[model samples]
Target: MNNNSQSLTYTQALEHLRAQALSKQSEEEVPLISALGRIVSSDQVAHRNVPVADNSAMDGYAINAEAQSASGQRFPVVGQTFAGHPFDRRLTEGQAIRIFTGAPIPEGCRFVAPQEDCEAEDGFVTVTRAFDEDSNIRRCGEDVRAGDTLVSRGTLLKPQHIGALAADGLATVPVRTPLRVGLLSTGDELVRPGNLLESGQIYDSNTFLLFGLLSSLPVNVTDLGILPDERDVVRERLTALQGTFDVIITSGGAGKGDADIVGQVVGELGNIEFWELAIKPGRPFMFGSINGCNFIGLPGNPVAAVVSFLSFARPFLLARAGAPFTEAEPVLLPAGFAIAGRRPGRREFLRAKRRFDGAGGEFVEKYRHDGSAQISSLTFADGLVVLEETLTDVTKGDPVPFIPFSQVGL
Candidate 1:
């Protein structure tokens, strides 16, 4: 077995994975209402007119701008225009129409004065304020032009995107189908929860943790349950699940142990592209392919598994699912408390809770416990305070880069 232990840096590993994922998958058309959280496979161009036709912006009188004066000009209200109704009547030099919000602007009128600035008497209306040209009138193509691109390709469809498409009269949108993934766990000392744990055996938490994480993504996940640390069983399961899922994610058994068979199985079944990373706690992470299905081998430690999945696997899955390229950009803020001791060459993500100081200033304070196996650290943290690979010491007043979990939809 070739044990080329030259590990890849975090940036290099991400670049390699992105380069390997060159195949663009098929797309499907989904209803506008059901397209939230889905990625658009194609550019969404406006098919019909936006605002559909000329409409009102407010519940006010639609009249000629030149007809109103400072003292007040009164004109008889010939007809009324409500939403979904068009006044075919043409407004003469001194004539005006009573209009509601979203109603089409009547012909021969170029301006609309809001109702608050106007007073209605008997059958006439008086404008007390000077109305500007095109005031309160929503033009036919003001929101969006015909044939304009409402949303570009690779955009993750949010509620705002849906509104934009709906305004363009699009009832359905074309989006990429969710990627299917197969999940597995390997460890002889691991047992599922509710089962009896013998002396040294530990309850398996990686499966549930991974399942919860995968559930939030735009992917279809198939749980392969737990597999023992035997090479043959691992190979058998990999062979059976081949061609069914786009990717396979296995936790544990990537380390250099006698029973660690994931690296060997990846090499035997397919190409082992990379076996290790330079990141802390997740240095033994592995990436490869088995029978054309991508495989990721994560560390056994619960916190390390979640970190690796979030930093590396999540982006790849999103890109394959047609989401736009998104990076975990950090926000620089002052640290609330002083942190002691730091490694110089490797980046560290310390769990932190965000709080506002007495002066109403926001700050992130590091948690007390930061063990790799402490899953509760992540649950209690609002974000991660990133200590750069170059910085060896940090003071309380020093600026630090932090990434909030909420921004990434975690």
Candidate 2:
């Protein structure tokens, strides 16, 4: 619980936010069909081995590896095994069984000779060449053993994971319940879209922007609408939301302006763990708690709101929802532009588009404007170019860290 005088480094603040994740962890069992995008609550072990039996991996003739087979040697084909059918009888030396892919191999069979490598005539197979040793057999438990962990706890379930769980015959899985998140936007000069705007009033796009971002997350979001700059109204609305939400995210009123009463009221109602960050476009960001619910206040500028949310709020919320939090690893690429006459001491994220040269070289081109209020820059951007705090100037072709929007689920 500190004020703006104790602004935290990005790494320090993220560590602090993720440390509180376990306090909000809870679990529920859901059908496998409904488990996509949900976090696993515990390790899911395989109940049975994949390919429960040793099966043929190709359409071929299953024969004993020890059989005396040569170019002119012929063996009688006694049985046939399809995918759903199996040859129950045992195989003897110099005997061959016709088998298809996924069909269980007959007893005493150690190799499968591809049908193309042998000649079949009058219920007999003639080996055209030497036998391959123990080939084309999918062994039991090769993919998954009964006691092996199929998926670890805290994994964000994806399609491949669902397939693995299905292979183990799982009808239901245990996952963390979605977090309850509330969204609030504060500004007196803001008006909702589809409404006529008066003097000095602009459409409130932050509500939709934050709503779209929250919709992609594993949380149930409730839109609390917009609040004016009045301190009493902001406090009243925030007070009513204290215990109902797992986290309350508010945009605007986090700065020191006269109208920025949201952070002030939050401090009075609960605790402001940190009120500032050492980063450009999000320096006014705030994180705290009211009653038992967590709170995050974002800057009013549209682009700043986005950067703060992705860099801080997204990871924190995911961690609290039983998923592990890890910082996004940036890909280093050369800068397509130059930076000069910029102050140091704060990390900055610039909206950028990646360009590739004809010879397979890649670089990042930053948006023309660096203002936090430039919302159009985000639309044209494919990702963010990260400038270190100690970096004062960046010449064209200098290597810089870049993080694509897809990496952060944007």
Candidate 3:
């Protein structure tokens, strides 16, 4: 592996890691109720007829169109049809049957006049409004045809998709099993929150941050907790977890320093493909695979971890889980404030709050103290202002690309 730290940029590192990622290899059957957020592994076809049969679209009378329009168009109300009942009543000419919404349209009925459009007298109803062929008639297979492909493969099932599949009468769907991911943090100077920290020690926040981000994604996250900055211990832990997780994510210990053992361990235990990106706040990153499991080593700084995750790791993970290409496109919006002192040939992501000015104009105000180590900036920011590598100058009103926190799986 190349030990040159200055040769890699964020984009190059991401491309290299993404090239090594393999799509999900396993799948399982899950009930529709529990299928939300899971990726479909096979195309799902409708087993039964949608609507199953012709039904009523409103609470009105079901009558034959020709009979209702005939002379002396007063039809006797023979019976009624509710949502779950079968309307077995046979209709004769000039006879109407009362029907409610979702009730199956009875035999010989070609149109339905809503209750407001008819006048009921005694046991007969008179059609006061003209009837069209499909005024209130919901024909069978109108919304979905039989044996039609309802939801295709590679779709991430949401609540709406579940309902649609249910409408197609599917009780269960085949989906890829959730990928199990392991997270690790390395540093002897880091302590867990709520514990009394020794002098010159800071709290371990990367584990929690990575865990939270991974929890919302369609993967099973296992927090390996914190590991001390000892080479033997770190190497032992990595060796134990190398084959257990689909991917191992670590924070810190990736920079070019004497204590940075993450890159060295990965190189020894597996193939270390890329290191160091050209992106701001996340240049010291490592990506590769260990024992056939993907490995991503992010910067120790909170903002750098988040930025690398959003711009690189998130998309790679999503792709491995069978998400489509369009889902990874970051939402780009106009910059809200001026940005100065940016270096060319490096991409920068700034924390900012996104809002619309009066008259529905979009604006993003860069947060104060946008430092890589500032964890508060991530909490306060609504989105990120993305600066491209080609350009350095940015005016206040210039249109710059951005990614909202919501879009980036935050």
Winning model by lDDT: 2
lDDT of 2 by residue, 335-390 (tens): 99998977877889999999999999999999999999999999999999999888
Clashes of 1: 0
Q: Write candidate 1's Cα lDDT for 1-410 as tens digits.
A: 24557777778778876876643568888889988878888888888777777888989888864833522888788889999888977888778889999998888887887889889989888888786677887888777888899899988888899999988778899888888889888888889999999998999999998898887677789888898878888888888888999889989987766678877887788877545776766777777777778888898999889888887888777876777546699899899877667667766778888889899998888888878899888889888888767777888878899889876667
Q: The CA-based lDDT of model 1 is what?
A: 0.81
Clashing pairs in 2: none
lDDT score for residue 299 of model 1 = 89
Best by TM-score: 1
- For residue 312, model 3's alpha carbon misses the true position, in angstroms, by 1.6
Better of 2 and 3 by lDDT: 2
Candidate 3 per-residue lDDT over residues 71-154, each given as its tens digit: 347788889989999787667666788999999888888788888888888998888757667678888888888788888888
TM-score of each: 0.91, 0.90, 0.89
Pairs in clash, predicted candidate 1: none
* Model 1 Cα shift for residue 43 (angstroms): 1.6
> By the TM-score metric, which is better: model 1 or model 3?
1
Candidate 1's TM-score reads 0.91
Rank the models by TM-score, top first.
Answer: 1, 2, 3
Q: Backbone clashes per model, in order? A: 0, 0, 5
